[model samples]
Target: MNNGYFGFCGTPTRANSQNLAEKLSCLHLDAFARKRAEKFGLDIVTTSWEDNARSKNSCWGPCITDMSLGVKEDKPHPRDFLMSMIRKPNYRDETCDTPIEKFCVTVGNEKKNSSLKRITLKEFLQDIALYTDNNVKPMWRDRDSQIVTSVQA
Candidate 1:
């Protein structure tokens, strides 16, 4: 799993570049999948972004280590911290801004799964997202919450 910064889509600024940035910013995950999709010339099926409100140094650090690590000086792996934050979105679900806390991953037997773990705020940031029906893929399956698809016009 990958982690970093995140945000929600606003409105399109330019034609595609600005619009793409807004859509990308709205996702609860980093630009990993988006970047990968662009790299492989694959059609974008999801709108995700990097959660920048969490940490600067590393997402999996000071917070977890602060409690779990015996030594106060030892640093934890940044990836671990990033994973934690990427699991949850930092927003309310009452309005268009629904919180996204799960990530999309390929599981064995051709299954996709999203894992929810505990992460420290000092370790990871969160992505703010706007509500939309543009999502056609399931964020995670065989999990607790039922995944829904929403598209944006």
Candidate 2:
């Protein structure tokens, strides 16, 4: 949680009677964390992932979505098997101004890439300002100011 700057950062899903980490983030946690970060003179990001998962009590979104290869299902595209099963997220709000703290992408396929597919992924990242003005800003830039530090490994 931003190196102790945050206290109760969590993911989209809450546990069904689970540990503190599984507990959904609430006002108490946020206020405490905010106060602590401020007391430390830190401007760290402190937000939890919204519960975009469709099921109310599922342990994992994928388990609820239950996407499968569907080997026997008549599929139009190779990716369609994975895509058609999961519920797409609707941010509840219509605007695109939500600030992104981090971006993580995990792909199961490790085989050769198609030129068309590769270009699409490249375009997607570029559209999100992931390159950060050609490296002017590093990722997860969640600070009030930028301080370039030199560390010896």
Candidate 3:
């Protein structure tokens, strides 16, 4: 399954870019993505990034490695990541956003079974928890708590 990065909606200035990174970091994206995938009954086969060679190189050691799957420190470029997913035949675009809002999209066959609904951050996290309880091993208890706390704050 492919996952899009956050904060890819517009041309960001330097300050805006930093703000985006901070937001992404606070979101704990890797954990959130894993939970979302599980909620949709999808197993993560692998993860990848789409970026120019320079960006890829810079991200390689810390960001794109297998071990970095849920690492909080690995901030990814959302626009590049989302564009990469858009190119894939298996993914379907489910949501759109303007420069001021964040973007959301769906991957895999999940779209075939359900209508595309707007996914809120809270709902996404709840879905993740549901998926963890029903389909997979119970591993996200702490992560869910963290997400809830983060969201509340």
Candidate 4:
């Protein structure tokens, strides 16, 4: 999943600033990640955002929703394998802050017997590659697209 920037800076005029919102509205990192996941034959299950501080029960920042691989039937209990991605931005005003991109995989119920690991997007994809017997390399492109590199494992 991808996350949207709060806003943009360095605009010369009001008109430019207004246009920035429109141009950037569709440019989200989660969307790109979703595309990469789909390219690898993973099925998306759901997309939702996390609540911010102002919202009720707002502990986590805004984040994209959960996705599933649809491989539950192979398991005895029919538990769905799920994944979630979060793109965290680093605000310039926040000293020493760095951007964070993380992906988490869950094999069973989130509340029980689930193997959840939060790792870098690259590491997560590498794990996916190992799991699926496919060598996966995700390349960043402009907001419009992504380049996926895959080799049979």
TM-score top scorer: 3
lDDT agreement with native, every candidate: 0.30, 0.31, 0.34, 0.35
Q: Give the residue spans of candidate 1 off by over 4 A.
A: 1-29, 46-153
Work out the TM-score per prediction. 0.13, 0.20, 0.23, 0.20
Point out the higher-scoring one by TM-score: 3 or 4: 3
Residue 93 lDDT in model 2?
A: 11
lDDT of 3 at 56: 22
Give a tens-digit lDDT track for model 2, residues 81-107.
211111122222111222232323433
**Model 4 misplaced stretches (Cα beyond 4 Å):** 1-117, 126-128, 139-153
Instruction: Please give the lDDT score at residue 125 for candidate 4.
Output: 48
Residue pairs that clash (backbone atoms under 3 angstroms), model 3: none
Q: In model 2, where do residues sit more than 4 Å from their true spots? A: 1-17, 20-24, 27-30, 40-104, 109-153
Poorest lDDT segment (10 consecutive residues) of candidate 1: 86-95
**lDDT tens digits by residue: candidate 4, 83-143:** 3322322111111212224333433233455565555544444455544445666443334
Over the stretch 1-153, how does candidate 1's per-residue lDDT look in tens digits? 134323333443455343333344343254564454435443233322233233543444332211111112223322211111122121210112223344242223322364444442212222111112243443333332322322221
Model 3, 82: alpha-carbon shift in Å?
Answer: 18
